[model samples]
Target chain A: MDTRERLISSTRELLWERGYTGTSPKAIQERADVGQGSMYHHFRGKSDLALAAISRSAREMRDSADAVFTDTGTVVDRITAYLRRDRDALKGCPVGRLTQDPDVMADPELRRPVEETFAWLTDRLAGLLADGRTNGELDPRLDPEATATALVAVLQGGYVLARAAGSADVHARAVHGALGLLTGDARRSPSGQENR
Target chain B: MDTRERLISSTRELLWERGYTGTSPKAIQERADVGQGSMYHHFRGKSDLALAAISRSAREMRDSADAVFTDTGTVVDRITAYLRRDRDALKGCPVGRLTQDPDVMADPELRRPVEETFAWLTDRLAGLLADGRTNGELDPRLDPEATATALVAVLQGGYVLARAAGSADVHARAVHGALGLLTGDARRSPSGQENR
Candidate 1:
């Protein structure tokens, strides 16, 4: 990758690990293996670089969600696929993690990507649920928008539980529990059957 | 308050806003309105002060949970009360927020109070759920531990969603949605409930 791409990628990684307040421009340069001049050549400073990185990360997250939302399957199948998709459970959600950073939340420009990503996810999930209800695949009585918000909250909060306990097992259990709540009627066991 | 108490309270307030990485000894002293020598005289440094602050916060959170857990009421009533308790939702949960701080997580001493607080909450909630199940108040097949984790996750994740959206309405809606799911009943509209 070129220096500019390398710099953005490195910044994204650092931001995930150390957050905006903890990450330094020097650390980004070191991680990218680029000189100061090369970094400055591409972006104004840390904030400028972070805005680019966050925007890229947001796009990447949205694209991943879109893949699940548009999959040729039932709503449960698609949502199950999205939840059970390969994830670094211990690392937590990249976009969700930004919500906890005060510096990131303070800047409108820096916060836009994080805000937009979640808003988009909630809307997308709500649409999928609405589609399911329309097809009679889910209970028509279910409120799509509320259920979507609850579904996303479970994943984000599961990370907090896991990280606090220093165990990803808690997160996995929470996911299993939520999936059970969503698909309980189809299964005899408390743990829901794996989605085909 | 004594000097030591003043230092701890100041640290808690600052940690809530700035997090561990962004907080410094000089800033802490300035916020506490205590001299450098006075702070050092009471505690070794920022970390020491933070440890004391975290311990205090954890204790307060646990005590708050204990009140709900020990209340003589139905499990749903108690849980709802805990969920609806007044809070500065925008400020977020101090202990939950610390889980996102890399520096705080890295220090075992700093992380202990946070870990203990969540652990205690999980156990307390699980106990209540178990009681409900045994008394036929909850689903017999429900896993107390898993359900407790999900409840806690919902609350923590609700804060993140609310903060990101810049509205506590989403948080309240998410909480109500989870409660509805737990009860396995649709929420009645105000008029419908009154008529019933």
Candidate 2:
């Protein structure tokens, strides 16, 4: 890749693996295999490079979600696809994970990508749900905005659960649970008992 | 508080605010107002102190959640209470946020409290939902395990969204959405129309 592309991509991976505090400019330089002079030539500072990386990651996250959001399928199918998509549960959601970093959250410039990405997801999901309800695919009683928001939350929250549990099954279970709710199978337990 | 107590509490705060990699022994010593010898007398190192602090924090999290789970109310009311409980959205959940820290997730000992905390929450919420289903307060078809998992996911995910948006409102909205689905209010949009 080119110098700027290499730097941005390296920054994204470093940020994902180590977060803003743990990720250093020197580390970025080393990872990208670009010298200090090249890094400065590409960006003003660590924060500037971080902003570029975060913005790119956020864009990628939205694009990936949008693929499912606009895919040709029933609303439930689309939502399920979005939720059940394969992921690196242990690593967590790249954009969603950034919200946990104090450095990223402290900077408006750094935080904007993360912010806009979620806003876009919530809005996109909301629109799809509205269409589903209008077409009688979803329960007429469903609140698109709320349910959409909940679905997005489920995916993000599932990562937290999976990471904490050190297993992807927990994350999958969480996703299945959310999909059940959206698909109107809310009353059926995976094990065939209500409480048990 | 005693020296040990002060040390534990300070470590907990640092872990919450700075995470494992970001928090240092010196920082903890300063925060707790204890000298090197005192810190060593209380605990072996940062990890040891963090374990004590994380365990304590996990217990407190469960206690706070239990208050809502057992409060006098209908099942939906209890669930809503659990979701609506006051919180510091920007800071995120003490245990849930740790999932984002590579150092914490890498160490099994350090990860135990976080894992147990989420596991306990899922089990507790599932039990409550099963009771709700049995009591005829909820739709009989709702899967307790899945629904419970969904609720927990929403809370964790809500924190992510809220932190990303730089506002608690998004988190609150996500909760309301989850509650709406649980309460069978899913069909209604906020303005009584779709796409508005």
**In candidate 1, residue B10 scores what lDDT?**
90
**Candidate 1 lDDT tens digits, A29-64:** 999999999899999999999999999999999998
Q: Pick by DockQ: which candidate is best?
A: 2
TM-score quality measure for candidate 2: 0.93
lDDT of 2 by residue, A35-77 (tens): 9999999899999999999989988888888888888988878
Model 2 regions lying over 4 Å from their true place? A187-196, B187-196
Worst lDDT 10-window in candidate 1 chain A: A187-196
Clashing pairs for model 1 are none
In candidate 1, stretches whose alpha carbon ends up further than 4 angstroms from where it belongs are A185-196, B188-196
| RMSD (Cα, Å) of model 2 | 3.9
lDDT of 1: 0.81
Per-residue lDDT for B58-145 in model 2, tens only?
Answer: 9999999998888898888888777877788777888898889998889999898899999899999999988988999887887888
lDDT of 1 by residue, B1-196 (tens): 8888888999999999988988989888888899999999999888989999989999999998899878888987788777667666667889998988888888998998888898889888888878887889877767777778778888888788887887776676667666666656534321221111
**Chain A accuracy as TM-score for every candidate:** 0.92, 0.93
